[model samples]
Target: MSDSIRLDKWLWAARFFKTRTLATTAVELGRILQNGQRVKPAHGVKLDDMLQIEHAEQVWEVKVLRVLEVRGSATVAQTMYQETEESAEKRAKAAQDKKYYREPGASVAGRPTKRDRRQLDFTRN
Candidate 1:
């Protein structure tokens, strides 16, 4: 494995994403940041660099403890990096808040039905 790794490759190696394509897509969409600045998937990452990754409804701040060019097992990936304590706490608090403040009567999955759409319109009006 190389000492420096591509941002997308590292993300996949770290188990943050299932595949490199997904990580690249996220980076292209400006969802991944390095030291608070947006970076491309091709960006080179070094050990100890801070990464702020935004995925869906959650944000993560992880520090690169190791850099690997090749994908590795879950156990190996676990040793590749570590999330900051503050970031972990923030994530947990945000998750708890989201659970409590979730939209009432909202569908957890899939698109809304016709009836649901009508209800939404009437509620807005």
Candidate 2:
């Protein structure tokens, strides 16, 4: 609606984060970057501005298409930014890898084996 919007507000509006507070926290923690640089939550976001956002263990590189301050439906939120091709492909690959190769310990039962404890101790040093 306006010429520009604050980074945190836009991120929330675009559904990158569930709430404005989460968006602000992410920005403060350097999880959001504007034009390849870390920015404050109050930083202005304009059309076509490149952004790198890291959330939920996934990294997104998007180009701002619409600046909005009001949260909207998922479809509308998706239209607010365009994810780069490389980012999409990378996310897809990561998903596939995770699906096929889960962490070795993910299905482990109660106690750690001697070998596991020794391996953990070796890595801790």
Candidate No. with top TM-score: 2
lDDT of 1 at 97: 92
Cα lDDT of model 1 by residue, 1-125, tens digit: 57787999999988889988999999999999998899888999998899998886788899899988777899999898898999899999998998887564465357878888787777677
**lDDT by residue for model 2 (30-68), tens:** 999999999999999999999999999799999999988
Candidate 2 lDDT: 0.92
Position 43, candidate 2: lDDT: 96
**Model 1 residue pairs with clashes:** none
> Each candidate's lDDT (Cα)?
0.87, 0.92
- Clashes, model 1: 0
Per-residue lDDT, model 2, residue 105, is: 61
